[model samples]
Target: MQLHDFYLSGNCYKVRLFLGLIAQPAELVNVDLPRGAQKRPEFLALNPRGQVPVLVDDGQPLVDSQAILVYLARRYADTHWHPQDAFSQGQIAGWLSLTANEIHNGVARARVGLKFGRPVDLEDAQARGRQVLELVNAHLANRSWLVGEQPTIADVAVYPYLAMAEEGGLELAPYPHLNSWIARIRALPGYVDLPRF
Candidate 1:
C-alpha cells in the first residue's frame, strides 16, 4: 500500500492516523501540493481529483479521505472500527456526512483560509464550526465514542479538522466534552499525532 500524502493537510492526516491506529504499513508518497505536484499527469493517473491522501492498496487506488478511512476500516481493521450491523453503519454514516459537509466547509475551510491563505469567510466558517462543535460536544457528553462504546471510522473522519481548529482561529475551550474526546482519541493505542499549526 502507498499513501499519496501532504503533511499539512488534515484530510491527508486522517489516513496517516488511521494507518497508525491499525498498525498497518503503507509506503508514504509525499505529494508536493505547494508545487502543484498533485495536478501533474503522473499523480493524476492515481486520482483525477488531484487530491492528496489517495491510498493505493494492492495497486487499487482509493480517493477521498473518508472513503480511504472506510476502506481501511473494512479491509485492515476489526469490526470495532467499523461495525457490520446496518443500524450501526447508518449511525456511522451520519457522522461521516457531517464530517464531509459541516466539518469540511466549516473548520477545514477555515483552516485552509487562515493557514494556506485561501479566500474564505473566516467569520462564517468559524460560526459554522462552533455550531458543529456544540452538536458533537453534546453528543459526546455521555458517550466515550461516537457510534458506540468503542472508537470507529466516524471518529477518525471527524477528528482531524476539529483537533486542528486552532489553525482556523477556533478555540476548543468552550467545549470541554469535545476536548476530552480529542484527548481520548490521542491516548488510544497506536494513535499518531497530526502536525499542529
Candidate 2:
C-alpha cells in the first residue's frame, strides 16, 4: 500500500496509527499540501477531491480516511480493529462517522484556523469542541474502549488531534475520563505520537 498524504494531517495520522497497530508497513509518500502537491494534475488524477490520505493498494486508490480504515480492517481480517458483532459494528461505524463529520470538521478545522493565519471563532469553536469532548467522555466513562471491550479502528480513527485538543485552544481539564482514555491509548504497544501533540 502507498499512502499519499500530508504528514501533519490528522486524517492521514489515523491511517498511520492503524497500520502501526496492525503491524502492516506501507510506503509513505508525503504529499506537500502547503505546496499544492495534492492539487497537481498527476495527484488529482488519483483523487479529484485532492485530499490527503489517498491510499493506493494494488493500483486502486481509496480516498477518504474512513473508507481506507474499513478497507484495511476487512482485508487484514483485523478483528481487534473492527469486530464482528452487529451492535458493536454499529457503534464503531457511528464513531467513525462522528470522527469524520464532527470531530474533524469542527475541532480539527478550528485548530487549523488558529494555527494558520485564519481567524478562529474562539468562542464558537471551543464550545463545539467541548461539546464533542463531553460526548466522547460520556461514552468512555464506564468503558475501557469504544466498542467490544477492545481498541478498534473507531478509537484509532479519532485519537490523534483529540489527544491534543489544547492545540485548538480546547482545554483537557474538564474531560478527565477522556484524558485517562488518552493515556490508555498512548500506553498501547504500537502507539506513535503525533508531531503537533
Top candidate when judged by TM-score against the true structure? 1
Colliding residue pairs in candidate 2:
none
lDDT of predicted model 2: 0.85
lDDT of 1 by residue, 1-197 (tens): 99999999998998899999999999999999989999999999999989888999888999999899999999999989999999999999999999999999999999999999999999999999999999999999999899988999999999999999989999899999999999999999999998875
Q: Which stretches of candidate 1 lie over 4 Å from their true place?
A: none
What TM-score, computed on C-alpha atoms, does each candidate reach?
Answer: 0.98, 0.95
- Residue 190 of model 1 has an lDDT of 92
- Give the Å error, residue 139, model 2: 1.2
Off by over 4 Å in 2: none
Task: State the local distance difference test value for candidate 1.
Answer: 0.93
| lDDT score, candidate 2, position 58 | 96
